[model samples]
Target: MPAPRILGAAAVLVLSAVILSACAGTPEEAAPEVTGNAQTPTAAAPEPTATPEPEPASTEKPTCETIISESVVADFESLGWSAQESPLYIGSTEITDGLQCMWADFEGPAGDHGQMYGWAPVTEAEATDAQDELIAQGWQREEDAAGVYITESAETVIAPDAEGYGITYLFGEGDVKVADTKQNLLLIEWPKS
Candidate 1:
């Protein structure tokens, strides 16, 4: 009876040792792998977006004639003068009663008379007719540099009663005045009171 009891106790101790050893060596049942289709890779927090910059404003250049024309128009309009269309030309050289006049001021003082050129297409017959008419009217032909037929009369009045097509006069430095006139359709240039 004593031998059987001792054998039973020994068997129990060995079984306990075996259970402890297994627990120590074996890895834990890797917490029930909570795998569900690899949790849609937490969309890496969307990178913060950058704000865009605004565009710059545009700068454009304006022409010279446009400026001069506008200025003349404004000045005349202020003085109650209505402007009429006239032929466009450079300076005031007169070949006929019908001429286009433009003025140019080279480096000079204010109030100084500048060069003027008048332009008109005059046929030989028309020229002869004009000369005869001027002679009849007592306008003496003044001898000038050859090729330029100059006839001077007392300052001809520019009233509505004048006999020929009206004249258009422009005033300015070569470029700026022309630019303004072309742009603004300004009034004719004339002596200011």
Candidate 2:
């Protein structure tokens, strides 16, 4: 009987609390407000700029005609200097594993005056040794650049006359450019050793 009375008291207290809470004032609605200044854009955005590309390095192996200008070849041909067959030489010294392009002034006396252009897998020491050998063999030493060696001839086929010059431009890739100018020939690149 006491438990039933306590249960009834508890139910009455809960009902009273619910009625009081419902009678309480409802909360006012509050809208979200901007925290900072806001505006529409006045102008269009700028387009991004393009960067320029760099030139690619040359990797193509050189050919006899491609090594030198075609105009120069034509000019030499215009003269009596016609391309001759090769056992590639830099004043009678045979070169190996490279290209050779020669031209001789056959119309000249005894077919003497001519030019040679060659590149070979010759070491720097080998080129220097060849220069030394040429100097030893009476070839007039003209210019001696760091890697290039120039020698004039008194009797060598590179320059059988006093007017000619023998030149070697070492490209330091294990090759040397063996060239001369009496009639007219030139070499520019060499193979790597």
Candidate lDDT (C-alpha), each: 0.38, 0.59
The candidate scoring highest on TM-score is: 2
Q: Write the per-residue lDDT of candidate 2 for residues 1-193, one digit (tens) a residue.
A: 8999999999999999999999896864444445568644344445689889886776665555555567766777788676655555654677765677766667677755556676667777767777777677676554433345555554554433345444433334466665665223233433311
Residue 85 lDDT (model 1):
28
After the best TM-score superposition of candidate 2, give how far the Cα of residue 37 lies from its true spot, in angstroms. 44
Off by over 4 Å in 2: 1-63, 77-82, 90-93, 104-114, 142-146, 153-174, 182-193
Per-model TM-score versus the true fold: 0.25, 0.45
Give a tens-digit lDDT track for model 1, residues 1-193: 8999999999999999999998889544334333675533333345688879786553322222222346754554454443232453323223432333334333334552322223244555545555566556654443322232323343642321132312222222221122121212233232121
